[model samples]
Target: MTKPIRKAILPVAGLGTRFLPATKAVPKEMLTIVDRPIIQYVVDEARAAGIEHIVFVTGRNKQVIEDHFDVAYELEDTLKARNKTAALDLLEKHRPIPGSTSFTRQQAPLGLGHAIWCARDIIGDEPFAILLPDVIIKSQVSCLKQMVDLYNGTGGNVLAVEEVPDDQTQNYGIVELAEKINENAAHISNMVEKPAPGTAPSNLMITGRYILQPQIFDLLSKQDTGAGGEIQLTDSMLKLMETQPFSSIKFEGRSFDCGSKAGFLSANIAFGLDDPKLASEILPFMREMLDQPEAAE
Candidate 1:
């Protein structure tokens, strides 16, 4: 039987160079899509998927991320005293259980594999999920929840994949399918990180969601620097595939690559359109922008 996945690791150690000036002081994870920060959205998805423990692999200038999860006693008290019930309830919803969350410093920006390995002690011996905060997934069924459901049945590594154009496959970790396991899932024969265009094994590219086994820690421990002299997670995952069965679930969700400025802007617009209070105002503003002659020029 597949061991139930109870923990989730979030690697937020990267310097958001793409976001530039805005990320200079504030961690990119704190950047809000509409109202909530990016990391909060990821946490909410994890909670929806039944994740009981959250381990954040952090780096320098990342203390704000830790404090975001911590209780704000003075703020809560102020709300309570002012009789602001609704506002107080919203803040309390994001507070994590004391012992259920943990933070570990990654110290250096080695790579995704190293960041994930940093959580080894906390993860111990069970399967766990990894959700990249940069990839904000908007779905009816949360992306992590979809993977958790697949993990319950597959019992091995499960990665979230989406079909990308052939030419764009080179920009992502491409997965080769050995066989079709289901209508929307398949057995991943292998995965190659950022394969050269036209040389990609398949069009199914891995997104940021993953349900991984504990054995991956062993592989990552011995992993050498691969592409860009970084301990690439895809390299370790490829090694793990040799000894374990791996599967890929084609996630039925819209994923925004918030790591880039364009994607971030797009996410704000998409999320804004979904917000009931903002939609009516935002739509007309967007239409006005479209109708403006200067914007066209």
Candidate 2:
């Protein structure tokens, strides 16, 4: 029988050099999006997909992320004493169940492959999902939930993919699909990480959210660094595809790459526009910014 996917690995060890000063002491995953940290959105997606345990592959200065998932006794008590039921309830709603999360250190910035490998012990002998906290997928049905539904039926290896512009294809891992199962699904025969500009096989790119069989842990066990002197997950996946049934499910949503300055700003704006507390205040502020003569130039 195909083992059910119950655990998810979140790699949060990357040094956010792009956000430098802001991430100087804080882990990038703790950066807020409409008041909730980026990792919170990723965890919410995992929970929605019925994930029971979340394994975080962390590094230095990532203690805040662990604390974010833990209960704050004093804060909860203060909110309860002040009759802030709504605030207290909101906090409780997002908290992960006690002992539902496990943390392990990646030890080095080897690569995404190594980061995921760090969680190997926690994910022994079962299919697991890997989620990148930097990529926030906005959808009616959470992206991971959507992928989990596909994983149940297909079960070998599945990736969450989306269409990208031809020119933008060089920045992501591109795939060469064999056949189309449906509009949003395809059989991926092969994949290439960041192909040269204009040499991409298809516009589809593997963004984030992967459901991989446990055997992949073996492939990653001795993976050599590729593409950038770092062990890349795509390289390991390419080797796995030689034998496994690999497919990509295009997500029905927008993805915000919150790892860069521009993408981070865009996510803040996008989520800010969706939040009730910030909507009214930001709407006029945005309109005024757009109306400024400098914007037209």
Candidate 3:
């Protein structure tokens, strides 16, 4: 039987260079999409998938991310004194149980593989999930939950993949399918990180969610710098794939690549539209803006 996945590793060590000046002091993961931080959405997705522990592989100046999860005593006290029951209830509902979350520092700006490797001890001897906070997928079912459901049946490395245009394959880590497993999944024959445009094996690009076995840690430890002079996770996964089965799940969701400025703005608008309260205020304004771009500006 497949061991139940209980822990998840979130590699949050990257410098959000794409977001630039805004991320100078604040960690990009702390940036808000609509009403909550990007990290919160990612964590919520993990929690929805039945993950028991959250191991955050963080870097410098990312303490805020840690604090966000911890109890805010003064704030809680103030709310309590003010008799803000609803707000207090919301905070209590969102807070993770004590000892369920752990954080480790990645002292260097290594790479995604190294970042996940840093949390090896915390994730000892078990299958763990990795969710890139940069990508937020919105759907009736969370993306990680879908991957977890797939892992339960397949019992191997599972990745969330999405179909992309052939010409756009060069922009992502494209996968070559050995065969179709089902309507929702395919056997991943090989993975190529950002292949040259026309040479892409297939147009299915890896979306940032992963369910990997503990054996990946050993491969990442000796992984050499690949595409960017840093140990790439895809490179290590490729090696692990030689011995282990890797499959892809075409998750039912709309993903927002929050790492880019355009994607970030799009997420804010999309999420804002999802909120009933906000939609009533945002929709007509957006329609007007579309109808008269200059006047709205």
TM-score of each: 0.97, 0.97, 0.97
Give candidate 3's whole-model lDDT.
0.93
Write candidate 2's Cα lDDT for 1-297 as tens digits: 578889999999999999989999998899898789999999999999999999999999899999888889999999989999999989989998888999999898999998998898899999999999999988899899888888787778999999999999998989899888777888899898888998999999898889998888898899688877988888888888888999889988889999987888899898888878789898998899999999999
- Looking at candidate 1, the ten consecutive residues that score lowest on lDDT are 146-155
Minimal lDDT window, size 10, model 2: 146-155
Cα error, residue 122 of model 3, in Å, equals: 0.5
Where is model 1 more than 4 Å wrong at Cα?
Answer: 294-297
Compared with the true structure, what per-residue lDDT tens digits does model 3 show for residues 195-281? 986999989999999999999999998957877788899999999999999999999988999999999999999989888999999
CA lDDT, candidate 2, residue 173:
88
Residue 276 CA displacement from its true place in model 1, Å: 1.7
Alpha-carbon RMSD of each model: 1.2, 1.2, 1.6
Global lDDT of model 2: 0.90
Residue pairs whose backbone atoms clash in candidate 1: none
